[model samples]
Target: MPQTTVNLRSLFLLSPDVIFLNHGSFGACPREVFTEYQRWQLELEINPVEFLGRRSGELLLYARTALGKFLGARPQDLVFISNSTAGVNAIAKSLKLKPGDEVLSTDHEYGACDNTWELVCREQGATYVKAAIPLPFDSVSFCDRVWQKVTPRTRLIFFSHITSATAVPFPAQELCARARAARILTMVDGAHAPGLIDLDLEKLGADFYVGNCHKWLMAPKGSAFLYARESAQPLAQGLVTSWGYSERTALNADQEAYAGRETFERRHQWQGTRDIAAFLAVPAALEFRRKYGWERMRAECRTLAALTQERILAANGLAPVVSGDDILQMLAIPVPRAGAERLQKWLFNERRIEVPVTAFGDMAFVRISVQAYTTQAELDALVSALAEFYKDKGNS
Candidate 1:
């Protein structure tokens, strides 16, 4: 671990007593970023009309520009959303589906987004096909498995860039290209990819890519984005029709003579008069990470996560879901069946360690997230707690 990360802990507001191993669930905002968030909120309160009505559009565009630069996207193609789930819903709801049409995805997708597709498919009389790609597989093998499930009925392909519970990285770029070759639309749920990995939306070539800034980017809550390729913009519609709809149409006509009238960002940017402080504070979050040498910190965090996974696997006699090189800042290790929740509760109550013991099908996993604030001592405490818990279970 980097020595600077120990000092960087003071930059966050996390409790000193609790070992926070769940940065993947919702990221902890740094003090500077949170201050900027509050400053925006205070500015909005001082003069609501001036802040929201007169100045919000320009401010939002500026923030979006900064975020676009970070993600390697065009400012016009990206729009702000509350989270990846909302982004997925926007794309899924807008798609024209019919009976016998299939939306192909993997079993490793996030549960909430999976529900969105299922509900949309049910309403449209379409089929949601979940391809079962087992772990410990290479990118080529996994892509082949998912591609084999596609048929003439498959209209769309959706999967996570990095899975939620399992923490596996899928071959999204390769799959997207294959889907394009087959004339199928592609959507990528990149909820955990933004801050964890370097992103280039244009090069990745997904029709729609959704990522959360709050999770890995160190941004405030309700800050996420959706990037739609130019060709696919017509297929996207906002969940709620608002000011962006007619306003953008007129603006597009004036600016480009209706040349770029069909835009996804314009259709979804303004949903209502909501508190957009989080969205506006994205630049601050980006600056904070840059000032703190986030790239090096991320590398250190990945090393810490791999070390922790090795220690836990050695102690528990468990197999790894993927190779050590595949693990990033998060790793999910299998635990005893029916004991995951018990162990999670015990770690929280006994050791004040906050981590997720997620259940996926017949298996239970202890997912650990390593961040700049995390330390080896905290991880050691968790390992010690788990050792005690298993010893007690053996005696009982």
Candidate 2:
């Protein structure tokens, strides 16, 4: 009922004809931020050499400073990447995993990240161990369940701070603290945490962390960051060995003069000439959130997401995978185990509803993301469609 929540819908560029309930997949950028992104692109095209050659380092540093302040990390510890997947690949490939070594993670991880670890472990003869954390998650017992799988050969612990498939928020601080005591390296897939939840990378005690600004923070696409603890920086080299690599010493001294002094930035920041507009416009996204009182908007969206889940679950007669408090703006509601693809297409093609249908184990979920642009009527339409669709098959 907050006026800001209703009015905020107009600020985004998403189509008014469609009910977009999939902000979790890719965040919707505000008009202001998109304009800033374009301005940066224009500046880049105006003089390629001036922007990429002479001024990119300082411009990126300013952008990183803003992002670091937002993430509760130092600029020196963070570097811009395309997305969380890129960050995961960089770290996964960089870790020294011998045969019989293990990388421990939960079953609720993102699919791309899971594949990244699986490939790395496959190549090195290391094992990728997945802890099967049961549904209706209990935060108190979460760490205990994951810790039971740890062994002397366990080299790393990786889990999502907020899981993508199930939309559950894990207790990262407790798990990270436990991993630290056990002398196991910890890497967090925090793709959903940056804006949906508060993050203090320094205090979280994780050796490595990655967050997607393009998801919750409402930044332009291709904007994300990787934060490495000072101790862990040496272990995470760039996935693409570019001019940032130390052995590429022909340009290291000159690169250091302009690319800043930190090895983390030196290694990861410059990965061939690509669009840096998204990275540079991150400050504008932050400014838009601050200007529009996005905290209140996000809180309202959380309440809406919970209500949306309750309505869908009531229609399908299925239990939830996670409690309401465990999710923020995104809610994963269990749908009938019929055809998830059919239901998803039906909703989009027939009802003009935009939402994701995901299958986990034997269950199918309709993951709904309630953002500032979402409306009660839009959600009601989705609920009505689901009830009607399932009723046609006598499943509701």
Candidate 3:
């Protein structure tokens, strides 16, 4: 593969002193996108009524249209939310899971999402079943393992498209197909998948999917979206009951049309008054990627992530949890056993490198994210730090 020739590090607003290898956590937005975000904010401040009350619906429609085009979904089927967890909460709370009903998921889900299901299941007297997927992942057996856990009581299946802790890309399409055959609804957590991978929510056929534009897509913070298939739209209710809840109280002709919008949008779009600059700036983030040929850039980033994983694991003498092809621009490499927090802080404080050390069960791993702005030298810095950390362990 040809390497990216353009220098991209300068386009981001990340600190020059810190080697940022943690893009998977909270993304770093490009300077151009941030400027566009601020422009929207200024416009909102100049006339709050015009921005939020009067013209906000039309403006938001345009933004959602752009995002919908990018994700291959109808604009009416999508609604802007603060984050993926918010989307999960909206759907989880809305579902009327009866007593003895079960919601199936993998063991590799995000912590906050797991908490959402745990609390919801407890309140509703339902069971949340997390099927264990063994390491050294087998794609062939992946769907079977998950399907085997499903019982007649299983009402829904929820899993991440790309897992956060393990950095493995689950076979979401296959799982969705399987769940559909069994008359179970599927909701996909695509938090890290928007810009990192090719997506067509319509073709993927999940009942509901939520993704973060702020993560791999490089949008500003507080930018994310929830997608519902036309048939499933009525099942989703907003976390906050705001103006969009009723079409009878439309503010104006245009506002009324927005208020009488699709059941999905009308419920979730206007969630009280909040900063919508991040959501509106999603188009700018898409433009930035288009101008820079982000497909090739993502390929280069994935190469760097795989290479860094190889370099780090070679020193620690531990095998990788997932195949290189299964992941995109992020990788989780098993490291010498140690406290995850201690390992993370040591890397940040001693090495001036910002990375995440996460533990799954007893194994500890260092999750590295390579973005368009990442370079070989920063990865080299991480590799060197791990080598020193291993040496310190020997000496101790």
Give the candidate number with the greatest TM-score: 3
Model 3 — TM-score against the truth? 0.96
Ranking by TM-score: 3, 2, 1
lDDT computed for candidate 3: 0.88
- Every candidate's lDDT: 0.87, 0.89, 0.88
lDDT score at residue 100, model 1, on the 0-100 scale = 89
Off by over 4 Å in 2: 247-254, 258-262, 394-396
Q: Between the candidate structures 1 and 2, which one is better when assessed by lDDT?
A: 2
- In candidate 3, position 333 carries an lDDT of 84
Query: For candidate 3, lDDT tens digit of each residue in 1-396?
Result: 235566788889999999999999999999999999999999999999878878787888999999999999999999999999999999999999999999999999999999999999999999999999988778889999998899999999999999998888888889998889899999999999999889999989999999999999999999999999998888899999876666677754455776555477877877777899999999999999999888777878888788888888777788888875786788888886764557888888988899898878888889998887877888888899888877875422
Give the root-mean-square deviation of each candidate in angstroms: 2.5, 2.0, 1.7
Ranking by lDDT: 2, 3, 1
lDDT of 2 at 165: 80
Superposed by TM-score, candidate 1 places the C-alpha of residue 224 at a distance from the truth, in angstroms, of: 0.4
User: At residue 194, what lDDT does model 1 achieve?
Assistant: 94
Q: What's the distance in Å from true for residue 381, model 3?
A: 0.9
In the range 228-342, model 1's lDDT, one tens digit per residue, is 9989998999999865555343332222332344456656876777999999999999999899888888888988888888888888887878775678897787777656768
> For model 3, where is the 10-residue window of minimal lDDT?
253-262
* Candidate 2 lDDT by residue in tens digits, 1-396: 346534777889999988999999998999889999999999999998888877888899999999999988999899999999999999999998999999999999999999999999999999999998988778889999999999999999999999888888999999999999999999999998999988899999899999999998999999999999999999998878888765434342337574434488788988888899999999999998888888778888888888888888876778988875686788888898886768888899999998999877888899999887777998899989888888785543
